[model samples]
Target chain A: MKKWSLITLVGADQAGIVAQVTQILAADDCELGETSMVRMGGSFSMMLRVRHDDMDLGALLKGICESLNLHLHVDEDVASNCEETDPDVNITVYGADRSGIVAEVTAILADAGLNIIDLETAVAGTADKPIYIMTIEGQALQGVDALTEAAKKISKGIELNIVPIQTLRA
Target chain B: MTVLDILQYPDERLKQSSKTVEIFDQTLKDFVTDLEETRLAGPGAVGIAAPQVGCARRLVIVDVSQLKKPVDNHGYLLLINPEITKWQGMEKGREGCLSVPDYTGNVIRAESIRIRFQNIEGEWIEFDSGGYEARAIQHELDHLDGMLFLDRLVSRRSDLFTRKTYKK
Candidate 1:
């Protein structure tokens, strides 16, 4: 049986954060899989899945945190057997930065029987007139029409481009 | 002219290399009409290939004139046994295919190209195409050799984007 663990780390944005963390993982002879890292605001965040040889995970976390000046959280019981389906579509929302954008959109998707697989958002421009861009990729549970109508109900001043995913591959 | 059914992805027929057209008969002409009708029927479709419609012939149709984006393009083109003779400059362009409708990806293609092809009348014609027109043509031509934008993704993790929905 494979022992899979999930780990999350966050730290103030700086150069070489990725190198330092990766070097530590390499030193431990651990296998890293399914990872995502991003810079949000003034901080950097990372989430990763790993398989280690029954090492002291608590001590490893402390060493990583102290050396990289970051915080670490780990869950040892993550199930690795679940299979994920590809998303049915990709929704991109662009408008003025404001609260509730993700909440409202995710609520609509959830209600329409859509499962969000991945999401990324960023705010650009200025503090006074920031541009909020959100991309949500997920699988549709029902049909395409239901999701389109739900997306259409979003507030004005926001531009939504809905593209139907080709379920076929070449 | 009737709109032909487009072959979706994972169809073995789409992966087969198309045969070059040697005879310009009425059957070929009729196929072109159906191809044009099918392309027009697709939402925002500017070009299409024969393999997309399950035909293994070297044929494609392109017209970028009506798009909202102002592009340096020739009005309408019907290419038969088309071949790119020369190409220059490289740039990344976002593209979605009618056959591969669900995803869009950034593909690196030549910014400008010189191509030779047979028109509807079976006359070999050559032209210098650039910008969006060039990109569209390259995408359709890739189908002749059984290639999709997914196969040309600059980076599978970063360049590929799932399309939301196409609204009229």
Candidate 2:
């Protein structure tokens, strides 16, 4: 079996940050897998999975972090073996931008015994009068009716839509 | 005719490039019927391709009429040897494939398209489509070339999502 590592880096955004990090990993004989990078606020954060035959990855990655002046975290890849549940319900929420929308909505989901598989939130419109939109894909631990009932208890101002997602192979 | 089983990923056959329908005979028409049956049987499935059912032919069926809000659609479309002549406006939307069960991804496709294809009757047809209809057409068209939505993902890791469960 191939050994794997999950690596993350966070630091100030700069040009050539990805290129430098990838170059270092390539030089270390590590095969890169899936990578995700996003800029939040002003800082850039990246998460990627890698596989390697050598065991000196931790020390080598730490050295690269030092040279790049970025915070680094590495962990053995354990997620591949674990069973992951797919979300059965698709939830969309959109309304005025407010502080507690996510908290409230997530709380409802948690209370319903649902697991969030994928979520994306954005604030659009304008800063002064912004519109917040959140799309959540969640697995139902209980039932669709239970989830729907839980969503109904949320505050009235926000608009919410809960639909069962049909998974097809084509 | 009956609904054919949807071939899953790693089946090897799904990766094979489909050939254009050279002879539109009774066999081809029968296979197209089976393809339509399979598409209708699959829950919430709006379109299907020939390669998904172990047939490597340039054929696809798309019908957005059942959707809640199908925009700029031609109701039901049976495309053979479909080709996109012009595309406009890039948009990213979530899509899942019947062959790749338990996963969905954000695929960037043209927001609107001017496409040309032959109908089931073997006559050439051209039309314009936009929004969800266009997205569905593109998704099915990719199958004819041995491509899945996963291959067109905007960002592999971020755009790809594992489905957690099924309701219907």
Candidate 3:
């Protein structure tokens, strides 16, 4: 029986991190699955799924992590049986930087039964006049109108725009 | 009227650039009829291109009259060898393709355009279009040059999204 494992790696950004890690996996005959690697705030982070049959992949990864001064975590991965829903709307919020922006916006979505499938936040502008921008791709379980009405509760100073995703088959 | 087969992506044929409609005759008119039928057969499709149906000709049909929400649109357009002479502004919008059935991507397109094309009768016509109609024309025009929305993705990582199934 093949086992699935989720591996996460985080370390200072440097070249060859992907090449070094993937090289080891290739040599071990580990089949790689869904993976996401990104550089965030001067740190490189990678999350990947691997399928293998009875290999000490964790020990090998640990050795590489120790040599490279990186952090690694591996855990058994179980595929979820839940039905997947596609996101139907895009939520954009931008305003003066505040601590509760994400919290407040997400709380409204949760109350409205909107499931956030993807989210990205960025801070821009000068240090003194920082601007917060957040974009969320969400599945509106309670319909777009319900989600829109619920979003009205969001406080002022924040500009919120909700656009229903229109898919054109041309 | 016949409904033509829409060639799916990776077909190689879809990547081939289409030729200009030089001899517009009964055969071209018949093909346009079939293409319109095929577009209507599709779910919520607003426009279709000649190459999509395996005919490598610079022809496209667009009709935004039936859209749920009212917007500025040219009722129904059947264009041959359409060309965008002028365009202004740019905005990122999500787009899906019948050829690439399983994915949607954010692509930046001109917000408005001045276009010229030959009607089915082989007479040249010029018009200005904005909003959804302009976007549809741009999308179909890309097919004439063998370009997909994937080719114009705003960001490879952040812009592409997958759909579980192409709703029949």
Candidate 4:
């Protein structure tokens, strides 16, 4: 079976993390492709896309990740199986920070056969006047304004905005 | 005359400052028509700035009545030599450019604004607006000053794509 893998390294920040990660990838006979590493809020988060050969792939990867006290998720050849990115439709939701905001929106989009392509959510300002901002991308199954009117009703109590966005071609 | 083509980036016309709408005459009318036409010719465009159409004039046209925001918008206003008199609220939003097609960037601007501008007839008009209408006016006005929404972006932190939604 052809194996295309995505390895995510998320844990506490420390030295040798990157080196250890590369070592693990090399040992797994995987070809490393693109990578993004960030240290924020006192935690190190790194993600890499890789292609791996067969022979005890999943269990082997789990062992290495467990030893390092990290969580690892491996998807085999998913990109080659389905390489197309989800079409993005930009939508904004903001209100007083509260629970279930993401679930409410995602559920509505989910019901409409739309996938949450990407999401950026933040709670800003002090706790007294905390502001919640969520920017999301979802794929439209049919056409324009398909989810808009329904969103308008669900969005009344909350501030919702939608705009079509096309990302940079890389 | 024909509708002026909306100049894309890397074009020198887009980099230069637009001329002021000195006289709101037939020539100016043609420019406004071209701006509207160019705006209509593309994907749903909320606004256009004069510099985008190769005219370095401080003129812009905006209409966000079609947006889903709940607020008052004055339909389409052909602004010649417009100015912002009052502004409030702060927001970081995702914005796209008619000049720079196929890319959307993040931009932050005042949430509301009171603006003064000259109509196509050279008569002065003023407006107090908020929500998407206010955002469209700000985006268009930025064009009047040789600015693209890209210039206002805080960072590449957020990009808008209708289809390619996120970094995976």
Candidate 5:
């Protein structure tokens, strides 16, 4: 059995967060395969994906965050499970950039009982001309038309577009 | 009608810039035939480029009237040594590639576009289009630049993939 690893960082904008996180991540015999980091106003946020054959990474990450005086939380990854079932689908949300877009949209998805397998989100444009783009790959729950209905709700704040996973046939 | 053998990822020819045609010669005619034939043979086919058939040249053919899309467009359009001059509107779409088989990605594109291209007779012509027609134009033009739909993929989230369906 393979264990899942997640590394999350949050703290005042500073230099040592990565140096410290990598130290703990390395001890887990984990390999860092994916990462993204950014500075938002006065704080720094980072997300990373590592692989380990151990137990929950959430508890380990929480202790690290506490010792560093930063706020952090981690949860079990869901995308890996979804990938095992259907391997094709794309869902995205786009709109005016704003705070809590991820929280709000993720909440909506969870409430609808949809399983979010993989998600990538970013704020493009400028501070004065901001645009938000959030992409989630998942399957709709029973009695849910994930592509159209979810898009309509997300669009109330941001434009939404949904399409089936792409395939090339010759 | 010849169905194109889809080129796959990391094929060096796919990354090399395409060569521009100096004239609408015999080679150009052959490309049109191949492109058109490939378009017809594909399942839910709409358009194809010279490079998709393994020829790196400035030629492509498109016919989208059969698919469900935005507007009424020409039945079939064959273009040579083409170039786009202007466009309007902004849209993000999910586009797949014959070369990068079995995967789809998000692509931001123009809503309408003005373009110029030569016919098989060497007569150059220009036109304007919107909706699905514009998408076809952009798709074909990207082929001329040696670009596949994969380059425009914003993220891996939209990657719809299938088990290896086509071989070189």
Candidate 6:
């Protein structure tokens, strides 16, 4: 029976990382599924889902990671029966970089029963005066109006904009 | 009126550019009726295109009045060989398509537009539109050019999103 597993690799960004890693998987006849690889702040990270019958795949990947000085983790993929829900609204926050911005903003969302599906935050502007910007895609369980009201609770100086996502079937 | 079958994404036919509509005969008008039926049958669909229904012709239907929220719009437009003659400003908005039912994406569209097209009688008409109505028109027009919202994603990683299962 084929086994489903998730493989994660993280290390210093370098060329040929994908080629080297995929070559090992290809030799084992693993069927690749969804994969995401990105370079973040001088570090390269990869997450791959694969289906294979080979039980020794973990050892082979571990050997390769050790030789290349990269961190690797392989684990069995657990299937969840829960249906994935789409985000109903988008929330964007912009303010001077300060502590507790994300925590405070997320707390308000939680209070309104919003489930965050995707979030990306970045600090921009000058080194001395950084601006924090966070964009959140969330499932609004309590409707957009409730989410909007909850956003009002956020502290002053931080700008928050909530736009309901309109789904057009065209 | 017949409810036409909508062609899903990756069908290859959806990618083919549609030909311009030349004749404004009764057959063309009948097809428009079927296309509108297909649109109305969709869940909250505000617009539709001929290519989406396996007809590779430059025809589209847009009616933003169906939306619960009131917005500036031209009620029930039947546009043939539509073209965006002028446009200005840009805004990023989330968009979903009937062809690509599994995903939605953030797409940057013109905030306002000046467009020209023909009616069922082949009479040329031009007008300006903005807001959600403009976005809907742009989306349906893309079908004529074999373009999907996936082609204009704001960001591959951040902007593209999986759609939720449809209720009902």
Among all candidates shown, the one with the greatest lDDT? 6
| Candidate 6 residue-wise lDDT at B40 | 90
Clashes in model 5: which pairs? A79-A117, A168-B102
lDDT score for residue B122 of model 2 = 88
TM-score of chain B in each prediction? 0.91, 0.89, 0.91, 0.85, 0.83, 0.91
Please provide, for model 1 over B18-112, each residue's C-alpha lDDT reduced to its tens digit, 9 standing for 90 to 100.
99999998988899989989888887788999999999999988888886546788998999999999999886556777777656665788879
Candidate 5 per-residue lDDT, tens place, A117-166, comes to 67877678887989988777766663235435544455366655555443
- What DockQ does each listed candidate score? 0.11, 0.17, 0.29, 0.05, 0.08, 0.34
Full-model lDDT, candidate 4: 0.70
Residue-wise C-alpha lDDT for candidate 1, range A28-102, written one tens digit per residue? 887887788888889999988888787766687687688778988889968776454566566777888889888
Q: Output the worst ten-in-a-row residue range by lDDT, candidate 6 chain B.
A: B159-168
Cα distance off (Å), candidate 2, residue B84: 9.6
User: Could you give me the TM-score of model 2 versus the true structure?
Assistant: 0.64
RMSD of each: 9.4, 6.8, 5.3, 9.0, 9.1, 4.8
- For every model shown, the clashing-pair count is 8, 12, 0, 12, 2, 0
Q: Show what share of the native A-B interface contacts model 3 retains.
A: 0.44
Angstrom error at residue B20, model 2: 5.3
- The complex in candidate 4 yields a DockQ of 0.05
**Alpha carbon RMSD to native, model 1:** 9.4
Q: Residues B31-80, candidate 2, lDDT per residue (tens digit)?
A: 88888989988867889999999989898998877765434569889999
Q: Candidate 5: how close is chain B to the reference, as a TM-score?
A: 0.83
Classify candidate 4 by CAPRI docking class.
incorrect
* TM-score of chain A by itself in each prediction: 0.91, 0.82, 0.90, 0.69, 0.49, 0.86
Candidate 3 has an interface RMSD (Å) of 10.4
Model 1 residue A106 CA deviation in Å:
1.7
**Model 5 C-alpha lDDT per residue in residues B1-168, reported as the tens digit of each score:** 456676666877777667877876786677677678776776665777787777887877777666543356876787777888998877655577667655555676687888898888988999887766678779778877877777776655433332222211
Candidates 4 and 6 compared by TM-score, better number = 6
